[model samples]
Target: MAETTVAEVMAELATLEDPRTREVNEKHGDDHGVNLGKLRAVAKRLKTQQDLARKLWDTDQTAARLLAILICRPKAFDRDELDAMLRAARTPKVHDWLVNYVVKKTLHAEELRQVWSADPDPVVASASWALTTERVAKKPAGLDLAGLLDVIEAEMKAAPDRLQWAMNHCLAQIGIEHAEHRARAIGIGERLEVLKDYPTPPNCTSPFAPTWITEMVRRQQVE
Candidate 1:
């Protein structure tokens, strides 16, 4: 079989765009119109193609970069490359997919986590906190949970929306996953009131840290 070229992939993506999808995504700061499920189907057909992925990403189209992240060899990107990609990925969905899919799987995750957590760019810092949240849940031996709470208490309420949401997730994770720190996490959430009134669909877990922490803890207890 012939290798799929970037031109071919881009042409296919152009066919997937929907104006309605773009409208909804635009409300959330994403510009792409391609339905993600359909995009993933395209990636599945193409399989991993690091060379093609680079070409797709270089095109700087949201849907193309998204396709790039899905099809690229995550571990193949070096620290600098991932950092550059994160900075370039300004849209919500592209930034998110790159971090969650590619960066998280890279060998430099922890290294980048340390650097990006303190980044002045809130969007970049949000990625750091997201990585931290994963560590808080899975591998938290050396993590300063108390220090994290302190930072969240002081900075989260005043931080930009994306950074605040990331910090809120970390706070909720600590509260949900660790019994000793649960009260402090809840206390911080209650006092700060971040996402306290954010709309939530029925039966969905609220992103408000206190409620999120409590509900998750209850589920754990039931289990």
Candidate 2:
């Protein structure tokens, strides 16, 4: 059997584009129209093909890059390569998958997290906050939860949309996971009022920090 080529995968993704999907994705700053479920199925069939993943990523098409993240070995990338990839991933979904799927699994995550947290680029800083939120939930020791609250209080309100949202998630996670910082986190959310009026669908928990923190805490108590 022949190995799949980048051209072949690109053609396949071209065939999977949906107009409505593209419309919806574009509203959120993603350019791809390929359904994620279908894209994952393609990755499953392709399996772990690092060379092929590199080829696909170099194509710079959003769907191909998404597929690349799925197929590549996360640990194969060095710090510089991962940093380059994150900067190149300008769109929302690709940036997200790279952070969540690839960067998070790498040995370099913590180092990159510290570097990106102070980045001048809000998109990059957002990725750092995403990583920090993970630690807040799963590994809270040694992290300055109060310091995080202080930063969120000072900067989150005026932040760009992506950075603001990421900071808000960190705030909510700190409130949800840490008993010591819960009150301060909620209080910061109340004052900042970021995402306070964002519409949430029926039965969905609000992303607004105070509401999100309270609801998650309530669920924890019930559990």
- TM per candidate comes to 0.98, 0.98
- In candidate 1, the residue pairs with backbone N, CA or C atoms under 3 Å apart (3 or more residues apart, or in different chains) clash, namely none
> Candidate 2, 84: how far from true, in Å?
0.4
On residues 1-223, what C-alpha lDDT tens digit does candidate 2 reach at each position?
8999999999999999999999999999999999999999999999999999999999999999999999999999999999999999979999999999999998999999999998999999999999999899887788888888889999999999999999999999999998888999999999989999999999999999999999999999999
Q: What is the lDDT of residue 72 in candidate 2?
A: 100
Model 1 bad stretches (over 4 Å): none
